[model samples]
Target: LSFSLPKCDTMERFAGRVTVYSVVGCPHCNSAKAFLKGLGLPYCEVDVEKDSTVRQKVKELTGRSTVPQIFFNKTHIGGNDDLQNLVSNNGFFSPQIKKKKKNKPSDLMIPSIPCFTDVKGERDNFAELILEFKSSGIIKSHGSFLKVHKLTFSGSELIEWLVDKKGFEKDQALNTGKELMQKKFFSDVSGKGDFQDGHTLYRLIEHDCLTALNSGKTAECSPVLAAELSEALRRLILKLYGEHLSPDGKTVDYKAMENSQTFQEYCELATQLQRLELKSMTREEKLAFFINVYNALVIHGHIKMGPPKNLWQRYKFFNGVSYLIGGEVFTLQDIENGVLRGNRKGVGQLTKPFSQGDQRLQVALPEAEPLIHFALNCGAKGCPAIRSYSAKTVDAQLKTAGEAFLEGDDGCHVNSCKNEIRLSQIFKWYKVDFGDTNEKLLQWVAEHMADSPKKKELKELLGKGNHKVVFLPYDWSSNSKD
Candidate 1:
């Protein structure tokens, strides 16, 4: 007689009420509400298209004009992407039921303990397994092309060992290996393909192994290193501002900067960044350090490589410029999308700058900080003004910058009669950072704007709802003092 493993029921429990702000004819809104229903989650849907007052209320509460904005217990959860990300990553609501299997042998009994409970627990178990594998003599050095040496083992060998020694089925063993790989325990030696049960060779990542060895204790930022880097970068930026920037901070004299002794000193100092210990930085320190470095790097790239003149050149300029920091090379794209934006994938990019095994991933912020859009200057006339930031004052400085930028006509414009608001293209490009919807974007703009007639007008329009959003054309001319 055939017998199977016991069936298990897993349920996802949410702690609060679910609400969806929707609009008529919004497919995403419909799908979002449907997803909640499918999961047996009861949600209150507010069709903003029908009620202008409710639309205004949603704009005030969540700062979003888009439909399908979700909330759990009154906490804003953004649009469909935000909802999906929350559900997938945070497990906000989950429920599953499975029927029990027929009687099985004791040897085939399923363990009550979950294979992996949490990230920390999984890492601990994977580390122990690695040590066990080492003791079992399954992992060893192998020769590859060009007489290169790699400490690795075949996928099939690991699966075979698991099936025979650990009593796991072949398929189960294969999946377990893949999970270990996903957790960054090991990877294909050539950095190609996923974990597979074949002759494919895989090796444990050294940094991951070291991390596991330390009992998963994350590295602490060195105060001395952070201070030194910050001070050096600050001095360079200040010197540039004093020497080459226009009094208004709107134009740059790149030609003069390229020929100055200060530029040489700046170049030499940048080399020292190779020793920057990212782990030694606090959030404030990191924000200040990276912002200054990014601004300085823009000037450096402009002088050294010349300003990018077209779309392809702009791509190359952003993606190719690099600095060796902490033994890793970081490009302009790396600083903006990887470091500042918390390792998010940038526009026109398929993946994040830092991969799973990359040491730099440890330096990324827990999430993207929206205020950074105001601090980063891309060496263009339309970009925000450059300024040196201090760890103690970065937050205040960014707020000041945001307010200053929004006060300008180029940053924001309001037309009460037309019910239209025009914003800088920066808002358009990094919409996700701002709020992911027109309503939220406008709310953010209004909030950051200085106390002015325009701010009051925008607020009044938002309060009434049914307004439109337009992104101003970006001025890409070089911020040159010609």
Candidate 2:
């Protein structure tokens, strides 16, 4: 592909690093500095006038008394005039890519491209997005560069993913990827490895891949290369907002969260997610997707209209605002009802389906997985702690979430002395989803709590069939961390 480098006085843009040592009140030094600056060449400036020691050091190194000593990526070139002559006569600015072997992989036939950071043209925001992915640990280092680990993507796939992620036009996405590869921000390391064979694998050469790999303490090694959208978003959430569970076990710092840059970024991502093709996504992907949407909407919706006074107030906000997906609009009610829960009228009555709302919405899952009650965050004091969910491990994750929620009094309570049990309002609200009666709910809870000591105690108590069951009052107070 053809590429253009931003023009300097007599040469195109320089890709490598530059260092300049200069003294004050030197016209040649000033001119040389201005020339580099105008070309958008990044450089390090060392003032020799203020530090005579540096002057002596430069003299010893270059064996010259010149005030303006220039170095292109540590290679010394003579003063202002000499620099111009080198640029005009020699190809000092442009570096060539090494050719591939004769038997290159078919999938990786896209010619080896360089990084985009060195390019001089206007870059799209997608470049920034890719960098964000890099910093968030989504993109990892491979060999001399960094790449989206565990996955290989073509330039077209990269374009589509970015377009969906940022809600950009298809052509704009294509241009962004092209520019990144052309400028060398993203490098085409196509024929590097057997795993990468036949795939257009672009490596991010700017970041030290080893450094990112070594830095991970909490990062689990996934066998796969690129994670699904759910996993990607999960990693971002964990890195940014984190699972800041409350010591009180009931409150979230909503005020601080609402003001955080992470939350703002989440809002942007969530908006783009609405435009993504939900129908085409996998069941696990859809489950993880809607959960993220629900949780994010809870944070964003509250930010739009302060914290609610009661649970009903929160419901009002959810109903008032509609979220978009695949060029269609849906409310929170529609997501929970039509999409997730298969059009159930209410949580307590699964058989009775909702009569009103967007009927066009398809059920994201074949059937509503009841454990979702423990995974959905309502921004309420009694809601479950927010955790990143991955489509690949969502079943395990949901199981863990349910068990943790059930361990608390808000979800389940047992009184050995009175032979009685009290449960969270969730068991009462979504009785149909869990079971038709308290006994059924207890059995379901037992099924989830297996292999734990609590299960043995619950089983013994529940077996008596004489224990009283009561539902605790639902807490409506905001779960804001602040």
Best by TM-score: 1
lDDT of 1 by residue, 319-429 (tens): 987765554557889888998999998878899899988868888887998889888888777787555467876786677678767866798989999999989998888
Candidate 1's TM-score:
0.54
- Model 2: per-residue Cα lDDT over 44-99, one tens digit each: 56655334445556666665555578755435676776666655333334222111
How high a TM-score does candidate 2 get?
Answer: 0.49
Off by more than 4 A, model 1: 1-224, 245-251
- Backbone clash pairs for candidate 1 read 12-94, 12-95, 63-439, 63-440, 64-440, 65-439, 221-279, 221-280, 221-281, 222-280
**Which regions of candidate 2 fall more than 4 Å away from where they truly are?**
1-260, 347-360
**C-alpha-based local distance difference test score of model 2:** 0.55
Error of 2 at 63 (Å): 70
Q: Report every candidate's CA lDDT.
A: 0.67, 0.55
